[model samples]
Target chain A: MAKYRQIREDLRALIESGEYGPRALLPSLTDLTARYRVARNTATQALKELEQEGLIQSEGGRGWIVRPRPRPRRHGIDRYSRSTWAAGKAILIAETASQGMVARQQIRELAEVEAPEVVAVRLGIPVGTTVWVRRRTTFIEDRAHQLADSYYPLDLVEGTAIRQVDTGPGGGFARLEESGERLDEINEELAARMPTSREAIDLSLPPGTPVVELIRTTYDISGRAVEVMWSIIAGDMSSFSYRFKIPD
Target chain B: MAKYRQIREDLRALIESGEYGPRALLPSLTDLTARYRVARNTATQALKELEQEGLIQSEGGRGWIVRPRPRPRRHGIDRYSRSTWAAGKAILIAETASQGMVARQQIRELAEVEAPEVVAVRLGIPVGTTVWVRRRTTFIEDRAHQLADSYYPLDLVEGTAIRQVDTGPGGGFARLEESGERLDEINEELAARMPTSREAIDLSLPPGTPVVELIRTTYDISGRAVEVMWSIIAGDMSSFSYRFKIPD
Candidate 1:
């Protein structure tokens, strides 16, 4: 194997093994050169390749540090619990709160658009039905984290606070409850796959990194899907936790 | 811009859009060539790349077919219900039963091994404590599905039936229950990442295909860890579904 390839694979294993946590600094280029007995240029190239892959970045005096990863706390089943959302916090915020990280949302745009066929199916609405789409880029510590494009039936949300630039306290789901429908359950389907050309550019994911394509649907007590959301999550940065009872 | 890349991206988008169901046939190379106005060689190359990516495969006369992906039934929360297990079937079997596929476990080996530090932490046992490990490679329709290695403290099972090649009736967990512990809950942590070099070869996962790294800890009524399992699931061939109630 090429010297750089060997070094790259070793470092990759270390990261995956959780030996290096998010934002943890990796061995310096000098350390790599001495340990791997390779030329400084070879060591530098290996690190460069890893950077291009989006797994690491040079932090000036801090040298190369693992890109801020989504820690274990970013994913929890209780994220949407009434206590959390009704308390005026976004589920995303609650998901990452255990890490002591504050998340901010930048609403890029909000529009009423025709729902795609897939989204329509999930919402039990006619394809092409006008839907309210709130597009936002979520950030952790001001760095891009995930992209959320949430769709709701326009007819249902048009006159409500959900149609506003800010959905007020508790966000959309809480407002949905205030609209007289209570959210009873949520369904999430997850898949790991390479990002689309758009996602790669938008998320700044490194090469060889996959994205978790998450489709979430929120259902009211009437079993109606009031919200269908598509989230593009950076794979390496996140982990999802689920706790469920074994039915008797 | 390469013609093949254009074709590949379009087809990939279509797959991700759920336009084609599992095992559905993709457009033929001839059709792709005509539709995209690309040379036959270019279209073939596109299909070839996708095949290498494990997104699709070609059967002799059937042309290109979407690789068999895990349907929604494969990701039910009820998979571990007592009824399902007591019926003499693995939860994984129940998960894929809706697809009309039978899964067979090829138990590669069973042995008593010293617990690794991580496993020891999860199992609440001392590091290097003797433990029983049942390593198995699961197959669906004779294709490798996932690798599961389950660990249990030797002291808890040295005199029980769980140490045998076949933990009769339901499964090891069932036998564990019979040995006086009642399962209370399950905690699963899921991460998506590229498979390791050994995993790629063992699971026959295609290059660039990510795997869902699932670490599951099964706890007894008293909240003690009884078993710790690590499952490496092929990303493309699997889907995970979670349904949780929003607290009232």
Candidate 2:
């Protein structure tokens, strides 16, 4: 095998065996060169290969470190059950608590804006209709986990607490229900893709990490779409669970 | 703004505006240099930025081309409903037909192997217990879309047609039901990550593409875990849709 490839394989085995655990620093390029009797470029190539494989990351001057693989937060359909959220349970906090992690959210932007084309279509509103949008970044263990943007039609939530930065307990759905738009169903679509440079930085994602885009539309008992939420979740830090019966 | 960034923004706007449609090749580096009065490296840098953003691809000697964003195939819970698959409806073919696209599957491997740790856990089997695994790559419109591997307890399927490369009619589930194991429910978990080099090559994924990993466990009415399927779906080519009532 090529010298650089041999080095790469050795390092990969080490990482997989848990010898180099998550976030643990790997030997510096200088050390690798000295131990393997290879040039600095060869050592660098080994680390670069690992980075491209999403196994390690170069931390600026701190050198390469095993990319941390946190226990993924599992999101079950039960999170949307009225018993959980309507009782004032915050979804993020509840999920994090199960994993013994702390959770918080920073409200980034809360304002009334023109509904974008996608949001309008989902909400059954006219193009460019005014809407209320609440954008926030959710954090777990002090690290950004996802970006959520919830949009509501102006007529549906104009003067409601849903327009505020803090929607109080149970979040926006509760507020909507209290306003008489009791949520009856939810339609969720999930897609995964590479994060944009901006998203990567915002989520502190490692190189090669992807993000899952979840778009959910909540419908009232009267069959009206009341709220549409778009979430960009850090793929490495989360997994979504769903259970359903197979209808005959 | 830097010259390369300015060029990138212009190209991005063109792509977003549909002026440069999917799979459309951009101007050659020479042409770009002449038109923008810039060095070849500057034009190359602009294209590299787009590639990293998952917007374009370098086709070796053919140069850079806009990445084709095929209309994603949406998967809903109904796909697993007994009415769909029990009628011998092949999931992939039915899904593709809905999109007016062609679908095919190539069975790569059918054999009995010791269950891996993850599969064992999901199947409620002891580690190293033998299991039957069927591996296949699914294609849509002649492009690879996903890799699926289904595992069954060896003892349960050892002498059955389920071990065949093609499980006739309703696929594996149908045969299992005939064998007295009626599926009652399914548990699905989804996570996304960068594909390994082998997976990337097999799926023909672009530089920045990711794969959604879906692990589904099927349970019989008796609550026994009967089958576990692991699917690595090409992120750029698919989305999963699910709709359910918000439990009261």
Top of the candidates by DockQ: 2
Comparing only chain B with the true structure, the TM-scores of all models are 0.75, 0.89
Q: Which stretches of candidate 1 lie over 4 Å from their true place?
A: A1-73, B1-73
Across residues B150-243, which tens digit of lDDT does each residue of candidate 1 receive?
A: 9988767877777777777788777878888898888888888767667877888765578888888998889989999988887867778888
Error of 2 at B70 (Å): 2.2
| Candidate 1 displacement at residue A18 in angstroms | 9.6
In model 2, pairs of residues that clash are none
CA lDDT, every model vs. true structure: 0.80, 0.86
Q: Please report how far candidate 1 places residue B81 from its true position, in Å.
A: 1.2
Interface DockQ of each model: 0.47, 0.65
Give the proportion of true interface contacts each model preserves, from 0 to 1. 0.79, 0.86
> Across residues A1-248, which tens digit of lDDT does each residue of candidate 2 receive?
99998998899888878899989999988889999999998888678667855789889999989988888888888878788788998877886787788989999999889999879999998979988899999998888999999998888776777877788998888888888887899998999987765787899887668899999999999999998999999999899988788867
What would the TM-scores of all predictions be? 0.78, 0.90
Mark the regions of model 2 whose C-alpha exceeds 4 Å error after superposition.
A1-21, A24-27, A30-53, B1-21, B24-53
